[model samples]
Target: MKILIIANSKIVFGRELKEELFQKDKNIDISLLDFASLTLFDNTNQENQTYSKEFLKYKNIPKISMFFRMLYIKKVIQEYNFDIVNIHVSRWFYLLILPTLIKQKLIITFYGSDFYRTSNLIKDIQKVIYKKADAITFTNPLTMKSFLNYYNNFKDKSYVCRFGLKTLDYIDKNRDKSKTEIKQSLGYNSKKIIITCGYNSTKAQQHTKIIESIKKLDDSLLKKIQFIFPMTYGDNLNRENIKNILKSSNLDYIVLEDFLYKDENAYIKLASDIMINILETDSFSGTMQEFLYANNVVITGSWLPYELFDKEGIKYYKIDDTKELKKTITKIVNNMKEYKRDLLVNQDIIYRLSSWKNCIESWVNVY
Candidate 1:
């Protein structure tokens, strides 16, 4: 089958998924077209630094290139003669709305943000696409529930295609190193590390709650723990906020300002004692899956629906009781061995549920 995968950009997960699919099934011809590359920046007069900011705002709002790109994508679809046109990002409604015009089988994959908090108009457009597509895949149950609630008729077409990881199978290979050795290498003391990572200050990730929780901890308890914030992008904003928070708090922490993207698994899992994901809403988090794979105790916010936690192997903290976050962290730190064993058993269950093999099998059967 010839599949055309369209996405907004060539981010880590996007690139990894494309490579995995092609490597597993060479018989399947897969082509990737990123709208980010197609949308050029108007850098005729602006400084280099200002160009990207201007371009991002223009691209995000979709006012600058929707019509022209929709026409271009339609032409590309016809020219390529693809059997299946799979869209990864929801914003591609500029093209998917005209699926009837393209004369090809359509598949739509819903990542987290688009379904959780979008305008009614965008949601309506998404509903039309959902109704028209041959199949719709959601990375997590929360997104699937959102869709099912919005469009009752889509019950037959929707399927849960949970997020997966390649590294899970071999995660145990790197567990030989002692936690103390890993901490020393990373320039952190042997204190318990509580790591939370996301984009700088997105309200959806709800990182401020994690920071506030740490700040509220008693100084006696706080002295034994350290925080690490490994932001993916927007260094300046994140750095300033982190700096201000650190200055105000008695807690020890580090903000890795270089913005590490590659080796995220090694840095986050190996260097830290525990991983925290406090998102207001999440369809599925690749980071959460990674932490589970590495057998690290993961504490996430409790706002997620029951469907998202159907096959869980991690602990959850209520969003309202963030003050209890520090106490939970203390318990994990005090009984690290017991928690580690629980995490190992949990990883086994998670591996069975979210292994790439299982995910690929489901994908093949979806059509």
Candidate 2:
């Protein structure tokens, strides 16, 4: 079957899916259109099709070009006659809204912030888009519920699609060399590891508060846990402020200024024992899923509703206040062995809900 995937600037997710599909079935035929980075008339055989940043900005692009892009995508889909067209994120309403108005098999995944945080007008536009969809996938139940309540319909169109990785098995395969090799490679020498990501600092991610909480930890507990900040991307000034805080705290920590690819991130997860985040209570993180799948202790954001995780048989520690944060850290460090049952349960639930292999097989069916 032929398929076309439309992704905004976050085309990495689509590219990864395309690669995985090819790996699973080399004969599969698929096309990708990164509408956020389109060029007006260049159909040359480049490695990938990309649009410019200006073209993607809803307020910046000329109206005529917008119409042209719509025609370009409509023509591409018609010419290819794809069996399924998947749009990765919903914020690109102008580009995707019209696609749903016509007759076609369409699937849109309401990934992360785009589902709950976009402007109301866009959400209203997507109300019609969601109705027209053959299927809609959400990462977590809370965001899914909020979205469905806003429209109060299309219940059947919604599906919970969590991101899972073959990580545990990957770690098991390289078990012999990994345990020590990775730790030594990264120069981690602490009794335990605590990791937080601030690739980009926004109020939602709460990079500052996370660091300040670490500063609040007592010297004894702080010394035992080596903190690692994957400061992959963010405003330079904000990152510098975080760096200064980390410096003054005198804690065992590593602020990774550069980025690590997916596999590298997995490698770090394998060596670490705790994963932390402070995003919006309802935010569903792809990285959190990876750590959960690895059976490591995952500390989740607090503003979330737990019924969904409970329904899925998932388990995690939730923290909002520094008091809860410090207490959870102490408990985990004191007896990391106690979390085995919870970890195993989480591991089972994640694999059951999010195996990419299963998702691909399901996609082959024209639902």
Residues 77-122, model 2: lDDT tens digits: 7766778788777745444536533456788877767766787877
Output the number of the TM-score-best candidate: 1
lDDT (Cα, tens digit) per residue for candidate 1, span 182-226: 677667777565555443445565567777777776777677777
| Cα distance off (Å), candidate 1, residue 59 | 5.0
Q: Which 10 residues in a row give candidate 2 its minimum summed lDDT?
A: 39-48
Which residue pairs show collisions in model 1? none
Q: Give the TM-score of candidate 1.
A: 0.80
lDDT of each: 0.64, 0.65
* Off by more than 4 A, model 2: 8-13, 23-27, 34-46, 49-83, 95-104, 140-142, 176-178, 190-192, 197-202, 233-241, 244-248, 320-323, 340-342
